[model samples]
Target: MEFVPEEGKHLHEDCSTLILPALSIGNVGQLVADLLISSMGSERVGYLDDPNVLPCVGNDAYGPFPQGDLALPLEAYDSPSNALTIIQQRSPVVKGMMIEFAKNMADFLAGSGKKHIVVLSSLDFGKWQKVDMSSGLQIYYLSSSNSNGTDENCEQLGWKKLQEYDPSQMHWKYLSDLAEGNVTVEDITSVEDELEEENYYASLPFAALFSFLKAKGLKVTCLLCYCSEGDNISDAFQLGDAVCKLLQLSHPTTGIEGGKWRVPLSWMSVYGPPPDVSIF
Candidate 1:
């Protein structure tokens, strides 16, 4: 993978923390990324060129109007004031290449001097066996950091460490071993065929990315939400606020009146135009 910098913008060295979304259920992670990028006024520094990502292009996502800036499959942004770097992925990796994509990302991030990585994703709400009515929406976290401090911090913020993240589970162990190079492709291919999609954690991009990032010796924290398909805009905003809390950043807001969260203009047509008013 190669990073092609924007004409005058380069990746910032001081922006050591990276926040990216894994394409997953509900596309909540992507929506949260949109909020963060727009609210923080992050500048697009470059884009990633990789064959693993299916190609896509669209008008600028965050602008109040179509600004003529093109968006790509994977683009990098930097917010110097916040000392943060963000990656917005507009396309999914090709099927059967998730691990390869993760490896490429791990290598690039490690080489780029990134100290911490925050991965955001959504899980199938149906997989959650229990629902707590008192809690509006439960957020789960899995950290690669050995430090107990990370857990303590998240706990203090009312987040639960993902209890399902047992690396000893057969599928989970397989991914761990794969990331550490203890398993061969032949071994993986054979076992993968026998694995069932019912093992929810193993199937999502977060699992592959987390395992690979951990093997790269980087501190990674994954924040996940559970939701069914529908309008997930509220879920995205909640998770976005959770992320800001985790990082100790203030809730960012655009200059919109009576609104704390900034919704990108591109969202207006996400579900297509509103029904014709005259039809009412």
Candidate 2:
């Protein structure tokens, strides 16, 4: 849960907003993070040193060629001009260690003087019940600053507030209790073992992160969409666009496809090497 800055590189002092991806359906959040980092040309500032996350390493995800830069399980990038600090997660937390991870992250960000957090994630489209077709690709949001209603800006942006977030409900209350340090993981496990009700939000990593960050008195907003597992690059672009609009970040005009965004070179083989042309 400690932050290890790269040699001669440190967290941006002016960056107050932290954009993070909650490893969820389609890994849309991570993809959006990739888009933001690549397009913005953000610099890697530091990485999280925590044992709770499963270890992972791979080629640098942004470069056009193999630069020998290793991508770790959790790394932080800073965009000073945009006043943003984005965290890119390439691995999931260890089983039963989510709460501890969330707590540590909340503490770390709070101590780091972060003022706002924007969490990007996705929902299972099969589980989503679309009620309004007119809205078109509904983006649902849950914010600590606007729990009772939608934020005016978000409303203007055509994003809907998550309606299922009732803290009074038993399943949701359990998470709040846990985030506030009033309940332990064992207590929750025992309670959940007795309950037969299945709660979707309670099971996602975003829920824990949101609750913990909110408990730390930081503004947290979760932007979510509904999509199933498949090629979700388009979903990532849409979410990335929404985030840019939400944060008022100026889109760099040097990217591909009319310069709206710069697609990472690592994405060239996203689906894996043209199906081995020799086999065709």
Q: What is the C-alpha lDDT of each candidate?
A: 0.86, 0.86
> Per-residue lDDT for 56-117 in model 2, tens only?
99898898677989999999999888899999999999987888899999999999999989
Pairs that collide in candidate 2 are: none
Candidate 2 deviant stretches above 4 angstroms:
131-135, 193-197, 253-258, 275-280
Q: List the candidates' TM-scores in order.
A: 0.94, 0.93
How many pairs of residues collide in each model? Answer: 0, 0
lDDT of 2 at 33: 95
Q: In model 1, what lDDT does residue 57 have?
A: 97
| Model 1 C-alpha lDDT per residue in residues 69-164, reported as the tens digit of each score | 889999999988788999999999999988889989988998999999999999998888777748798988988865331476778788888777
